[model samples]
Target: MKYHVQVFVSLKPSILDPQGRTVERALSHLGHENVSGVRVGKLVEMVMEGERAAVEAQARALAETVLSNPVMESFRVEVRELAGA
Candidate 1:
């Protein structure tokens, strides 16, 4: 079976994000004052072929060990079986 996976990686709240702060400052400067406390993160999408349980396990392992930094970042993984594949 083939699965579609989405991995969302973000900095832990305890960590300061300079890039997010910079973007928020830029937006405020551009007259978007309502935009505050902005956070920037990454979305990774991929397709993998495996059994349902194995695919989920692989996605979690990849997210924990490769896609995110354990010291400062966290991640969530979503998996869906592809249709007609």
Candidate 2:
């Protein structure tokens, strides 16, 4: 089986995101006053070949241990099986 995985990694709410704040200010300066509280995060996409349960477990483990920082950041993992290809 083949799995398509997506990991979203972002800073925790308790952590101050200077990049996010800077982007928010830039948006405001560009005349987008309605935009506020901007957050920036990264998405990692990959395809892996494995059993369903095993692939999911591996994705979760990778997200927790490698893709995100436990101290200041958090991550979410999503997995889907590719069909027909």
Candidate 3:
């Protein structure tokens, strides 16, 4: 069987994200006063097979190398079983 995984990677809390702050400021300036503390992140989804451990390792490697920056970001992976190929 194959599984689908969703990986979410976000900037570390200690890191300063000017892009996110700019977006938040723009929102407030545009009259979205209720919007607060917006943070930017990345999402990656893929399908793979094999033991859970192996699949998770593969996903993490991809996340660390291609999808996220280890210096300033953290990532998490969510796996779901699929019924079809």
TM per prediction? 0.95, 0.94, 0.84
Over 7-61, each residue of candidate 2 has an lDDT whose tens digit, in order, gives: 9999999899999999999999999999987889889999989898999999999
Question: lDDT of each model, Cα atoms only?
Answer: 0.96, 0.91, 0.89
List the candidates ranked by TM-score, beginning with the highest.
1, 2, 3
What is candidate 3's lDDT per residue for 1-85, written digit by digit as tens? 6889999999999998888999999999999999987898888888889888888888888888988889999999888887765
Candidate number achieving the greatest lDDT relative to the actual structure = 1
lDDT accuracy of residue 7 in candidate 2: 95
Model 2 steric clash pairs: none
Instruction: Name the regions of candidate 1 deviating beyond 4 angstroms.
Output: none
Q: What TM-score does structure 1 among the candidates reach?
A: 0.95
Query: What count of clashes does model 3 give?
Result: 0
Question: Could you tell me how far off, in angstroms, the CA of residue 67 lies in candidate 1 after the best superposition?
Answer: 1.0
- Per-residue alpha-carbon lDDT of candidate 1 for residues 1-85, written as tens digits (9 for 90 to 100): 9999999999999999999999999999999989888999999999999999999999999999999998999999999999988
Root-mean-square deviation of candidate 3: 1.6
Better of 2 and 3 by TM-score: 2
- lDDT sort, best first: 1, 2, 3
